[model samples]
Target chain A: MRSVSKYFDGGDTVANYKLDMEIDDGEFVVFLGPSGCGKTTALRMIAGLEDPSDGEIYFDDDRVDGTPPADRNVAMVFQNYALYPHMTVRENIEYPLKVRGVPPEERDERVAQVAELLHIEDQLSSDPGEISGGQRQRTSLARAIVREPSVFLLDEPLSNLDAKLRLEMRSELKRIQNELGITTVYVTHNQEEAMSMGDKIVVLNDGTIRQVAEPQELYRRPRTTWVAKFIGSPPMNLFEGANNDGTVQLDGGNSLPTTAETSSPTVSLGVRPEDIALSTEPPDTDWTVPGTVKTVEPLGEYVLVNVEVGGSVVNVKVSHTDAGPGDPVHLTFDPEDAYLYDENGELVA
Target chain B: MSVESYLEDRLDRDVDGEKLTAILVFMLPGLTLFAIFSVGPMVYSAVGSFFTWNGFDIGQFAGFETWVATFQDDAIINWSNLRALEYPMGALPQNLIWMLVHVPLSTLLGLGLALLFADLRGRSVLRSMVFLAFTTPTVVIGLVLLFVYDPQAGIFNELLRALGLEGQVRNWVQEPQIAIYALIAGGVWVQTGFSMLLYSSALAGIDPALLESARVDGAGRFRRFKDIIWPLVKPVTAVVVIMSMIWVIRIFAIVYAAGGPSGGPGGVFSVLGLEVYQAAFSTPIEYSKAMVVALIELVIALPMAWYIASMD
Candidate 1:
């Protein structure tokens, strides 16, 4: 897609911005954002379900911007699965082939093969209404893959499943995509799913792409404060501070030396929850701030401690810490672990 | 109190004596009206079919002889040289032919119109214009069509002449051979809007995602209708079919208004409902025969209603 934009009602309601991106062939790219953030709009534009008001889309070397969805040879699994309730599973799987006038014998053979691969062979004769949600999702996938299209699109496909089922199907979908080797574009708001399943994640906010990078790189080096705050669980903790020369003054009267080369005075200091270290006594680190523990939540593997530092609460993830609420502690972090951003929320380093 | 007893007391509170009395009091008027007007009339008609009586006086009990005469009477049945089948033509056969023509034509045309107008601009306005024929009184429709089919001044003949087909013009309602077909055409014009409304409402209720999925699957418009939209709207189709069949079977008001309660020329457009009215209100008033004809109409309608109810 090259600078594609979409408007809903005669250019009054803009759905997407001038988004430009390239998805390499056979790569699993995840469009990640919150609700109403134009992730689904971008996916729908690529599927030819929504027309781009400007710019053009290309499939390989051919421009397919004005092509219809049927002519695009792309299959999309809707968020609801959208299975035909009246058709048996086999008929639903064979519908594409049947519509193209494929012979009955070949259609049946292909239906059987897809059904066996999806483990829905036993349910071939049953209606979609009679199947479980997971099985219905598999049937939807089977229908999409039966045509062997150039690209496969999924719109939050695993969102309707239970937690355990969603995790199981997450890997199953990846395996199927790898086996088929089709260029797949998945749209989801779940950051964890994007992190775990995507070969590359496109982080979007308000119809604009913030950053497009591999998951680990995106986590370690976010392009903006929005991507930094939106990417991680419990989120990155940002402190309003001012940078002066080679030292940044924290809001709580603490100053830390930074290697950032920018000369900006106003900066927001960002640190991940796990990057902050907590100690009962003052640590031997040059970048240490004192705070009183406000709350503590314990999970099986780790504990999250919220500390009140200069009227702002910062969460720190610790493993088996003896810290409790109202306990005085020193929060320390290495200067290299800090993300510096200017007043405009653009990353400086 | 113990927990089980306490729970039982809570459950029993739902249908206490006062509540039950209140429910009965609220239901009394509607139930009484239904029983008196609906159930009472049905039972009375069934009983009256077994007896020979006029509106004023009771006659001797006539068993199933009136029912048998409904089929065997020569006045009710006649022979037609119009078609291949040489069997006796009667009110029943006439009603069946009207059903065969009007029901399918009305339904298919209505469905086609609905599909055409569903997504078009000014759809509501167009639909209302189509449904104007249904809202008009059947008597008015019949009388209006009577002039439209008049031999001399009717627009139909004028158009036929303008088209240079002068030999095709005829008295549409007065010709015994083609009178029933003319009536069927009018019936279809009025009833098609009804079926269209039924199918349009059902089509609106369908999930649009289903259609989008079919489109993504590369199914064309006709294939989508046949495989997806048709099956999804089967219940409404059944409703439309059965209702149209019942209307065609008991059509009387239009025939009376157009042909003066005797059916058109040669009784070519006679139906069972007209037969019932003629038997009950004509000279000497054969009330038993009227009840027999009514019972036959009921028998035909009840099975279709049952079949429609059995569908999902």
Candidate 2:
């Protein structure tokens, strides 16, 4: 996709923008965002299910943006699987080859190949309703792969699966993508799933692209407050701050260094829970904010301490220990780890 | 502070829970009507069939005599046990003939019209126009068909005459074999309107995602409907078939109005509906035999409805 924009009724209001997303051969890039963020809309544009009001999409230099879904040579697994209820597993997987007019012998071979890959070979004769939920998900994936399409598009394929199945499918999907070497675009609102499965995750918000980077890069060095806040399980904490000289200052005497040249202006600061350190006495350096402990939420591996400081709350990840409610605490972040944000919620460069 | 008053405040004004009230209020009138009309009539027939009775006189206990006399009648009477193969075979060929014309032709034609009309802008008007035929009195349909099928004055025979095919024209309702077909055409005119409406509503519920899935899978239009559309619409098909069967079996005024209660010349084209009428009100009322006929109609309908309802 290169500068593709599809407007509902020709730009009467909201214009859905899907930018130039170059998927190199065999790259598994995921589109991650909340609902109505045009993530699925962008995927539909790639699959030729929707027409772009402007710009072009190319499959290996072939201008295929206007191609019909069947002609696009792309396979898609829907969130609901969208399997043909009346068709048996074999027939569902064999439909694309049947469409291509492949002879019977080769068609059966291809069906067997894909079904075996997804471990649904035993389910070939059964109807979709007869299979288990996980089996249906595998069948849907096998149906997509059987076509041997040039690329794959998965729209929240594992979202309907239970937690255990989702985790299992995440690894299974990565393995499949590695084996097939097809450029795939997977869209989901599940941050953990995207973090685990995506080679490069594109974070989108409100029909606009925010950040596109490798999973860890996007997580650790998010370009904006929105990206930081939206990309984690317990989301990165943001605190209102002011920029003065070479430091970003919060309430009390706490301050962090900023590379922003025009440092005289105030700015908001963001810090992840993992980056924030908590203690009883103030840290050796004077760069710390004081807060009263509000609550501690124990999440098996670690305890999340929610601390209220100057009308703003920051959650700190700590080991489960003697922490309790109604305790006064000192909170601090590494100066380099502290992120400064402009007034418009953009990362201060 | 005051626990006694707080407990009293929670004590109650709810006579019945909402779900119970809603169920009783929603279901009562329909159940009452069904009891009075459908269930009550069947109970009346079963009880009445056992009596050596005229309409006014419930005579001595006849026991199985009514059931026996029903079948052994010179003209075939109600044989509920013999109802199975009676479909394509049986002396009462009217029921079979009615189904033969009405089921396949009305269903296919109605579905075709519904598919075409769904995307049309003036669909509501077109749908209402067809339903206008269904809503018209059965006597009107029969009268209208009578003129069209009439040999001398009817427009259809006149058109045949204009085309120089004089021998092709006949008094449609009076002819023995053609009478069934002529009556069926009128029944079709009414029954088909209903099929169209059912099909239209069913076609509306076809999920649009199904089309996308098929398209992605590269299924041709015909293959899509064969694999996906057909199964999804199966329930709708069942509903339309049962409803049409009920209407076709219960129908009386149309065929009688078109071809008269005797159902054409020698009663060769007589149907179970016409048989029920003739047995009840003919010169010497075989009122018990008419009860047998009504019971036969019920027997024909119940199993089919049950079977269709059981389908997933």
Among these predictions, the greatest lDDT belongs to 1
Q: Give the total clashing residue pairs for model 2.
A: 1
lDDT of 2 by residue, B27-65 (tens): 889989999998998998888877776664777677879
* Candidate 1: stretches off by over 4 Å: A1-13, A263-265, B1-56, B61-75, B81-90, B144-171
Cα shift from native, residue B102, model 2 (Å): 2.2
RMSD of 2: 9.7
Q: After superposition, how far is residue B13 of candidate 1 from its true place, in Å?
A: 25
DockQ for all models:
0.66, 0.42
Can you write out model 2's per-residue Cα lDDT over A1-349, one digit (the tens) per residue? Answer: 3222222221212435546566767788899999888889888878888877776777776777677888888899988998877789898888778877899999999898988899988999999999999999999999899888788999999989999998998999999999988788899999998999999998888777899899999988889888989977678888787777887677655676667755436677778888888888778864578888889898989989999988877889987546577788888777677777877788875
True contacts kept of each: 0.78, 0.60
lDDT of 1 by residue, A1-349 (tens): 2222222221214567778788888888999999998989888888887788877788877778788788988899989999998899888899988988889999999988888878899999999999999999999999999988888899999999999999989999998898888888899999999999999999988888899999999998887899999989899988878888888888988988888867777888899999999999999878888999999999778899999999999989988688889999999997778899988888998
Candidate 1, residue A228: how far the Cα is off, in Å: 1.1
Worst-scoring 10-residue span by lDDT in model 2 chain B: B81-90
TM for every model, in the order presented, reads: 0.87, 0.76
